[model samples]
Target chain A: MIWLPLVGLAIGFQIYWLPGLSLPSSVAAYLSLATLAGLDSIFGGIRAGIEGKFHDDIFFSGFVVNTLLAAALAYLGDQIGVDLFLAAVVALGGRIFLNLSLIRRYLLTETRLRWRREG
Target chain B: MSTIASPPSRGKGWVFQVTALCIVLGMLLALSLRTQRRAVSEGIPNRWPALRAEFINLKQQNASLQKDLAEYKERYEELLRKQATGQAATLGLESVLQEAKMLAGQIAVHGPGIIVTLHDSPKRDVNETRPEVIENYIVHDYDIRAVVNELFAAGAEAISVNGQRLIATSSIRCVGPVILVNSVQVAAPYVIKAIGKPDVLQKALELPGGAADGLFLLDMIEVKQQPDITVPAYSGSMRFYWAKPLPQPKEKSR
Candidate 1:
């Protein structure tokens, strides 16, 4: 869903407000918020794909990639003295570049529903 | 999520992803806020208690300084006023007191000398501005005691407070709320007569704000010396409890 980036932004803001919060507690709070956002996104993504709507592989790829990248950057920032915001930006930027090229339109149109509609 | 001839790879359910994300983010927010608060409530210095005590001592010293400074200002202003009015111009009395202290110290000291008297000032009228000044007025015996100590510190050969001859085993003790030197109780207006380098002893007495903070409790307290002073035989025992050194921290073998 379009909410992927929104969710990412929301999570960023949450952690930004409380930098020194230990990992376990952040995991707990984000888990609940992410659960609600994730469920809504999954349903929206599935519906759009079935309707031959805009393939959300790009969005899903971006979100997943960005999430992992963000976590890694945060860890790196902890290890080094890099600014957290800059680290987050590097993560988000890296994910956007990897997703657009890797997530293919051919892969999307070859789906089962698309085959049913054409063949 | 895209149309796929086969199907998408087995993706973790939204529930799992959501659960992971929510749990992680919450804990971090709380901790950052806590650490920020800790820094501000305590300043940069960790050894604050001693620093604060020193600060208090300094503030007390400052207050005494301010009192002296104010007196100096008033006297200076009075002199200024006199100079402006064309009255006989001269240096301030504080300087004169300082000079007297220096002169007294210079002229009175070592071996033997005279004993001068320092009595309480004339009692103030009830209508006086500050009542505490009069109510607490007294040549607190420590005034003499402090002078005695200063004389000792200044290498006085012999000393006495208020005409009482000091002996080898003598003590200046506060007994029954009345201070006693050589077992004789002396009241306000005590005189400190010493025999030593008079100049050094007097300079020692007037070395700045007179010893009232930890010594005498009165207004306009001072140390005056006799014209002729001499040192007598002096021997005394001094004792103090000494503390041993503390052990340092060490690491354990793992």
Candidate 2:
């Protein structure tokens, strides 16, 4: 968990601080969908961690597979002249919202239980 | 969070891997955003007004710079005349100056050469038949490059299209309906002026299987040779940041 925030910062610096380094416009759609999928996985992982159900294998594999599948779907769509990345975006976005709601509920219950014990 | 039954050491490893994956995700997000921003900013829709303003600014700067260069060149020539002792040295200096002027497009060139004019065909009505052929009616960037290439191969010393002098770095492109030469927008009828031996330039363009012949077969084009023609000096910057002259090998003393 500690390494997570540090790694995030390093990646941020690598992107925003580097000059004359840019991805091609054609690949933006694919990268965007992959990013969305990655976001969903990270949130899901956090929720699972908080609930004491986080599995090392599942979390790591899910992260890699989700991103790769999203990007692959986008590329396939490009080759076929269809907007398939939008499908990936919708699926990942729905999952992210669902994960957020669960996270919220767990936090609320945990806080209530702790307060009751203190009282 | 730590209350799970899994071993603490194994849990830490998972956390590290997941975190590393998150970092990769973050980098991808940043790159996607930057690429999108660049695409928008560099796209034709957003750059038109900005480029127009920049073109005007550069034109003004070019004029002022040319004036300053002429003044300095005159001063330098005067100094050279006063310092030189021999006629041979003076003649050599004059020849070098002429060579430099030609290469830099600094001096207005006048010689017997050819003038080639290209005109885009008049647009047709909405219901015209053979609609696919309409694309062939208009002049393209490649057509201009072809003609320019032929003129240079025919030994044209200087050339200009619609008053924009052609230089090594000059780019001719088509943006929508108009042609852009050295970043200046020009519309048809396009007039190309080349300074060389009149007969040779004319013959090169009139070659049976040449760029000019191809244009004539497809569209309306006019080629004329004159006794004298003038091509204006190049008005753009010639500064090169990346290209460098190769170092010469030192010769062993005999």
Q: After superposition, how far is residue A57 of candidate 2 from its true place, in Å?
A: 99
Q: Write the per-residue lDDT of candidate 1 for residues B1-254, one digit (tens) a residue.
A: 45554343243343334333433333333343343344334433212233455776898999999999999999999989878765332345456675664333322234444454556555546577785775355455555666667777887655666655565456787766587876777776666667766677667766657554433233445555556654432323324368566896784831
Segments in model 2 whose C-alpha atoms lie over 4 Å from true places = A1-119, B1-90, B122-131, B249-254
How far residue B229's Cα lies from its native spot in candidate 2, in Å, is 0.8
Compare the candidates by TM-score and give the number of the best one: 2
Question: For candidate 2, lDDT tens digit of each residue in B1-254?
Answer: 45344433334454565576667766767776787677666652221233445776898999999999999999999888877756767888899899988887877888899899988755434565685777677788888888999999999989999999988788899888788999999878889999888889888888999877867776557889988989999887778799999998885941
lDDT of each: 0.50, 0.78
lDDT of 2 by residue, A72-114 (tens): 9878876676767677778889999999899789889988999
Task: Give the B-chain TM-score of model 2.
Answer: 0.59
Instruction: Name model 1 segments beyond 4 Å from true.
Output: A1-119, B1-116, B127-135, B175-177, B210-227, B230-254
Report per-prediction Cα RMSD to one decimal: 28.8, 37.4
Clashing pairs in 2: none
